[model samples]
Target chain A: MIRRPANLRRFGLGLLVAMPAALVVWWFLAAPLLVPGMAPAFAWLLQLIWPQWGPAVEVNGNAWLVVTTLPLLEQPLQSAAIPLGPRRFTAAFALFWGLVLATPGDLPLRRRLRQLLAGSVLGILPLVLLMALLAFHFQLAVVINHQPALTVTPPSVHVLALPYPGWQFHLIGVGRQLGVLVLPTLGPVLMWAVLNRRFIRAMIFTGLLSRLPAAAGELDHRDGRA
Target chain B: MSRGLLIGLTVVVLAGCDAAPQDLRRALAMLHNDQGAAAFTQLQDLAATGYAPAQFRLGMLYLQGEVNAERRTLAERWLMRAAAQGDVGARYYRALLWLSRRRDADAVDAGAQALERLAADGFRPATLRLAQAYEAGDGVQPDVAQALSWYEQAAAQGERRAIERLATAYQNGELGLERDAALAQRWRRQLAREPFSLSD
Candidate 1:
């Protein structure tokens, strides 16, 4: 009954074929460079924030950096173990979004590849920005939460209510709760929606969108934008 | 004669097991009772057999320099033997011994290397010592960043000296660090939370 079941089926097949290959490329090539590359950038940002708060920074393997931050008494301690959680953009998500943006209709293989490559860059740029912001927020949160525990002598105050700036707390709250948890999967879907708004509208109304109440007509406007 | 022979055989069997345990127990008991010479005698027998605890105790007695004139030499011998057997106290004391020689470069290096290994394993005192060495350039190159790193590590392990040092460093911009009063106050606030003990 669907007008473009073949296209959907073809996209699924293409996804199955391309996913593993993409993962292999990301793991072997992209990850090694990308993960460690975050360290100096993170350190620089921290230094800019607090000129005197430089700690020993080093990359641990290729997946993350274990940063020893702050001195207690006069010794070093691990303040944060920052990991580059690449699951969001590395394998399944990348392939699924690529297929959605590339071969949404009955496009030829060359055209599909061109669309896929272009859409991937556009989709990944937002993700990369989100990751960098999250890293900064995450480190700030860690220090705020753990600062009191790194004590030498008896503390006069029992607890510190707000360790970081007021804005930092809000930033961390949003970054951790929304950006880190929700955005990875949602980002690709949203990106795909932007790329192929028409196809999404046609598919949705024909399938589940038709079953929804009259209030769902708002989505029709979105579909028309494509 | 046969009954007497049997009694003698039983006594011999009882004595066959190492008497080091009993000697150690007696030594501790004698020391507890304030009988220092008796304890020393008991410790000597067990220490001669290369018992680590006895050796460490004997080394401490000599290191105290209260019992004899050749205390340093005797302390070195016993502490070295105990250290070879991986006694923590012995290792710490031996490192301290080397560190105390302010003018001896070789001694400082030896102490620094030993403490560095311990520091890497998250030993608080060793971490603090290593940080100081880096800060002062006693046995190693003067690297304020490295000192800060070590101080941070020690602070993480709840070392009071390291924590205070960090707060001071941030406050005064010592150790090649920039002055940050906010961080200094933050650490100062932490110092108020619980009682810090040197023994910790």
Candidate 2:
């Protein structure tokens, strides 16, 4: 079935390449929406504008996740921070999709198709990370605003409870909050292992593709040579 | 090599690739793991070389009554050193220590003068203390005008206590207030509605 992991590897390379671009998009897109005279506080501006992201986070060797308000009530949620926001997604999508559609015109069919999908998926990273960061900022906003009692309630919400051990919720809230804030720039890191696997596979694919004939060179060339 | 050994070695290599990050992480871990004493020792080593955070930390540790030995003088010294480095935390403590010392009203004009300097430097605690001195005629003659001004400056810095004082002062026409009901009502509303803002 084209090997699911092989499919994922290509996805990660595309994402890594797109991360910086996404950062630029996030800054440019969200900067205008910020309150006047608030120059250059990327995290604060992002959090203020799209507070749904919660707050930025840092964890596990600078790894991160930028959570947005898709509101899954998820457990063991990812968290991170970086320069990220909503606008980057639109810009990355357009860039990746544009490259993908542009390739089919001149490149070989299989190569062109795969490149398109890889580009599209990879392009989504910047936007995905941005959305995640914005969401995290908002989550932090809520926490700062609510100062929610750090009590584990039915596993739905993890509060950072004090003086009481055995509570996963508090750790989750603190970790995830940190994870999401740092996730935008760092979220792509999650894709590294996946990307490494893909790169090896892609190299294998390249080896095989180059070794194999290009559709057997239409076969008629052999007859003509004879 | 056997596959398992190879895999283990590869994992070890990947894990050890970031030694610096690991060390920094370990240091941060000490900070969070309630090894404050150990952290303080390392921080003090850094502080001896004039690290701003370390100085600020030492100052705060002294001013704040932790289980550690009470070293008020050392606290002020470290706090001053860090404050001179423009560390906000150190500056905060500098204001605190300066304000903490109580003096008989007219006997120590120099202490009050020093407080005025801290107050002008955007230290909310100092501003409030100076205001109190004016309000109570503690160090100088009770000058309602100076008290009101100092209170306003402190209020602007989000000191809730000062905001409350200013609100009350304006409301009661105390501290040389001319009984301007309009201004008093405005300040009070600003406090109630915008707990942080300086104006209505």
Candidate 3:
């Protein structure tokens, strides 16, 4: 087993060194390239779901410009572009990478790399899904707000037969607040904690680790003979 | 001691989960899910029971989706009820609804008064709206000075739209203000640092 004091020091030092570097790489290179590419996928998904909406995606630097038809109150359907900075969500990847890298060097390089890959998938996929859902919810709000106008003629193209119920809007609103405020910050930490639970216990909860017989046995087994 | 602490924490967490907001959210979710009848059934009861948020939401729903005269009246009634209970959102929406009815001079006057009160109370959206009203002569008389003052108030509150407006006004010497490129640049820089929100 890795010495507790040395492991803690190494992890702390690793975090101090890796965090800024990871953030710099993510912000300057990876996010700019990867974030813009997500727009097309989002556009494809939106179009697939709401064919009549005819969602279009445009890349403007790090932001995705999503242009889609939105029903307006007392007016014909108008095309609106909602610019989403998905880079904000992808920034969590930097934190995830930093945490993964900051893990003590005792873990096998192959396993650490696997953990990093898993963290990336776990961290990013939900954010992507959230962005998509927020976009859809925003568009749905437009439809809901203009339900009366949409029911009338001249705007014969009905995006949805009936607008989503009010409770769904509240749910989306809550989801959005959580996604924006909580998830981006907490998600990476949670992922890191789960992935490095053993390391965490060894470093921070040594007493608890020793007190739990099963945990102690598992650690001993991992250290040598089962 | 640890076990007691854990129990205390659990109790606190449980206590923090207010059922009212959850119920309100569920009703709103029903409304968004196209289950208007069900949402209304829940909301109307809550609103009738003098739940300010429910009343405000019901008002907003009617304002947004209902075009009929009777529904409009109902929207006004619900909004008024909520506003009477000191719901700022309800008050703002009610004022906006009244302002939109420009044909009724009395309603426009009431809206202008309500907006002025809200602006004075340091409500950012209300300040911005009041400024716009003065600038465009929507519900109130076109007063460049009043517009500038309200815009400045909103800008002080870090309202992006107000900042942009002031920046443009200063740059072009609009609203009878002296053109100052330096002031315009400062506002522009502030705007750059201001975080963009979807709502904004």
User: Which predicted model would earn the best TM-score?
Assistant: 3
Candidate 1 local Cα displacement, residue A121, angstroms = 73
**Candidate 3: what lDDT?**
0.70
Order of models, best DockQ first: 1, 3, 2
Measure candidate 3: CA RMSD: 15.3
lDDT of each: 0.60, 0.49, 0.70
Q: Provide the lowest-lDDT 10-residue window in model 1 chain A.
A: A71-80
Deviation (Å) of A184 in candidate 2: 12
Candidate 3 chain B worst ten-residue window by lDDT: B14-23
Number of the top-ranking candidate, with DockQ as the measure = 1
Error of 3 at A157 (Å): 28
Let me know the DockQ for model 3: 0.02
Per-residue error at A146 for model 2, in Å?
17
- Write one digit per residue (lDDT tens) for candidate 3, span B90-148: 78878988998979999999998898887666566788899999999987789999999
